[model samples]
Target: MNAFPPAQALSGRRPAVAVWPWPIALGLLTVFGLLSALLGQHGIWLALSWAALSLPLIVTVICLVRAWSRPSDKGGRS
Candidate 1:
């Protein structure tokens, strides 16, 4: 017998975000990026904001590609 339940049973029809950390990190990054762009100092602020915005997008893309190419379920079920 299987030691754990089936993947679908554990998934329980939850949203994708429930299983990913990047979504929450990306959200926080976006909010901080916006705030930095609006309220931060001039020079460094632009750089910081751009990095904040782009880093998550790049990471998300990389993660998506990796996840797509891989055959295993590294992040558990749904």
Candidate 2:
């Protein structure tokens, strides 16, 4: 064990900004994508729909990759 607990700048106790933004943004993108796809058959709406839908998936992939690549800091078993 270390002499002192690892210090964190943000430390989960207080965030620099509210946590709702990302989730709300992702949900809005998904809703917009679905609506555009359902309402518009062709043209810009379809493009927008595809783009909107893809953003959340891309973000998810990025987050997952980052999470998987990093080692856990909260494990200690002897």
Question: Which has the greatest TM-score?
Answer: 2
Question: Per-residue lDDT for 5-51 in model 1, tens only?
Answer: 45644666533334456578889989888889899868899789999
Q: Residues 1-78, candidate 2: write the lDDT tens digits.
A: 122234443253432446688999999999999999899978999999999999999998987776566566453210
Native-referenced Cα lDDT, model 2: 0.73
**Every model's TM-score:** 0.55, 0.67
Roughly what TM-score does model 2 have, to 2 decimal places? Answer: 0.67
- What local lDDT score does residue 57 receive in model 1, on the 0 to 100 scale? 79
Under the 3 Å rule for N, CA and C atoms, how many clashes does model 2 have? 0
Worst 10 residues of 2 by lDDT: 1-10
| Model 1: how far residue 74 lies from native, Å | 12
